[model samples]
Target: MTKVLLTGASGLLGGNILKHALANKTLDILPTRLGGDFSVPEAFRGDKEILPLDIRSQTWLWNIISQWKPEVIIHTAALSEPGACEWQRETAEAINTRAVKFIADLCEHFGIRLIFISTDLVFDGTKGDYLETDPPNPLNFYAETKCRAEEIVASSLHDYVILRTSLLLGASPQSLRSLDERLKADGEAGKTMTFFTDEYRNPIAASVLADITLKLASGNNRSVTGLFHAAGKDKVSRFELGEKLCQKYGISRQFYKGARQDEVTLSVPRPKDTSLISDALLTVMNFPMPSLDEMITALP
Candidate 1:
């Protein structure tokens, strides 16, 4: 059985991948974490060893690198919250940049393939559907670090795949639904005038996105080894997504007062438009990006 080591295994994206891995019982899924006590969740119902890991600690990580020698290493752990990263610069750099490069260097030393999960935030929203060749114009510190991390992984390792994904939706410990819930809660509590219609993203459902990540990791494809966009086909604004959710679940979108991004007091400046349109991924998949309506059906 092929053994795979996945960091951030308890996270939204990592959880989805863990689900895919568990279903293939023939494969050995070695998930890592310092805390949290649960199987990867959903379709993945496997035994665990509650591995104590802190990727930032070079000594501990290198030990695992030399011992584990996993064929595939999916690195997803990071301080992803943009505002949080803005305030907590040191922690963000340690987790997002330093730790990633450490693993990339290890991969470079020992022949291994590493799949890095990156974000669409790397672009400044000056444009959408930014290609792999596009120059990253990060608007915030979080995006800046992520963009740098991509470079670190690419230049550091020979066998690696860096996937730049857009807004993700699905259930997890800290799911992409966090933004929606925050808005919904704020609105319900009589807090209004804080939603943005100007900010745009091409969000893909977790279940669907998981398959794409796996496809990129399954085998060696140097052509697809570099950065690639992984997102949904349709691009929609935050307002539209909110409205669709309301319509789907029979709720009201009235609470959210639509405003432009500039009006908001976000610690990190957000990109105005970043709706990825990747024909690259579609060509490889048997069934490409799933429609929003189809996604709703798949939601738990």
Candidate 2:
């Protein structure tokens, strides 16, 4: 049985990963949450050994690492909100970069396999089909932090896979409002929601991403150490995605407008296209990557 330590168990992707990992009893999962509430699927509640962890604290992390020596550490915790990260640059840097550096140091010292989750926003998005070999040019503070974190992981350990993913679909256990849900709510409220037609991404369901992550972690392949793009096969703009969501959920399409990227002003610069090509991951795993339609269908 492989002992796995998963961080950010209360979050969207982390919760989904925990739910998936629980199906395989062979995986002894010790999920670390910020507080008492372990908000994963109820079916897998009994399967998890919850541990309270403050990922920002290096001392706390060291203590946990020393006490519970896990074989693999799936890092999912981060200050993911772009606006929040921009507002709280120091906090974001601490959580995203400094914390990752701490984890890398501990993992390297203990010979533990590390699976670092990264974002496609690391790219400047000038080119849509971003390859794993492509150079990262982060435009926002959040992306900058993740890019730095990726470097920390790469330089710190030989046994690590820095998986860069894109916009995630599917309902999270945290019940945090997703982009689709927000769009629906705005439409219901008789408000105009302008989606970007120029900005593009290849979004994947959280469950699908979690499944792929578990597969990689299960392989325990030391050779699979480097950056890999794990995202949807088809590239679509936010406008297209919004249209699909409206069609699928019976939302009022009239309430939204297809605006270009330059029309909107944001706290930080957003990439025009960060859609990733998963050729590197697909070559190794024989499974088909989900299309935009397939991902939308999987959504609740």
Candidate 3:
């Protein structure tokens, strides 16, 4: 069995990874979340316990690494909110960038492979269908941190896979983690949801991402190391995605509105088109990338 340590077990992708890992007999997984009083869905609470870990603390991280000695460390924890990252720059750097550096160092020292989750936001949306070779031009602090973390992972270890994904749509243990869930919650609260019509992304289902990530972590494909795009096949606008979700869940169109990126006053500037070309990873894994319609249909 491949002993795996999964960080950010409380997040959408990480939680999904934990669920899938639990079902896989080949993996003995340890899911870790930042120490807190947060409540997780029962589905994520499998036979294995979710350990409390503050990746910000190097000592705590070192102890976990030394004690567990996992063959693979799937590091997914990060300060993902753009506004929050801009407002709390120090905390974001410490969590997203510095912690990743620490993890990379540990992974190198212990000869453990690392699978780091990155974002498509690393590329300035001027260009869509980004390849792994595209130079990252992050527009916001959050993206900047993730880009830096990606560099750290790449430069620090040869046995690392930096998976850059776009907007994720799926159910999380916490209802607010995924885009669809957040939209549903907002619509249920009788709030008007406005999505940017100009902003585009190749959004993938969290389950799909988890499947690919676990497959990489399975130690069955050591040759898959390097940066790979794991987004959806459809390059869709945010407004289109929201509309689809509304249609799928029978939510009234009245609650949803489409506005251009320029119309809204955001705390940080957003890229216009961050659609990714996931052909590289999909081709290698022999996996089919799903479309937005297919993903929406599969949504629970």
The alpha-carbon lDDT assigned to residue 170 of candidate 1 equals 72
Q: Write the per-residue lDDT of candidate 1 for residues 1-300, one digit (tens) a residue.
A: 666788887777777777777777555777786455554444443555536689999888889878988877888788899999999999999999999988888888877789899999999888776777788899898998998899999888877888888877776654333444444455556654345788788878776777777666564342356667888887888878766655554455555567787776776688988877677756655445778767755665
Q: Model 3 off-target regions past 4 Å?
A: none
Instruction: List model 2 lDDT by residue over 226-258, tens digit each.
Output: 889999888899989888988887877677789
- Give the top-scoring candidate (TM-score): 3
Order of candidate numbers by lDDT, starting with the best: 3, 2, 1
Q: Candidate 1: which pairs clash? A: none
Write down the worst ten-residue block by lDDT for model 2: 36-45
Candidate maximizing lDDT: 3
Candidate 1 at residue 266, lDDT? 71
TM-score of each: 0.90, 0.94, 0.98
Candidate achieving higher lDDT, 1 or 3? 3
Q: Provide the global lDDT of candidate 1 against the true structure.
A: 0.75
TM-score of 1: 0.90
lDDT score at residue 10, model 3, on the 0-100 scale: 93
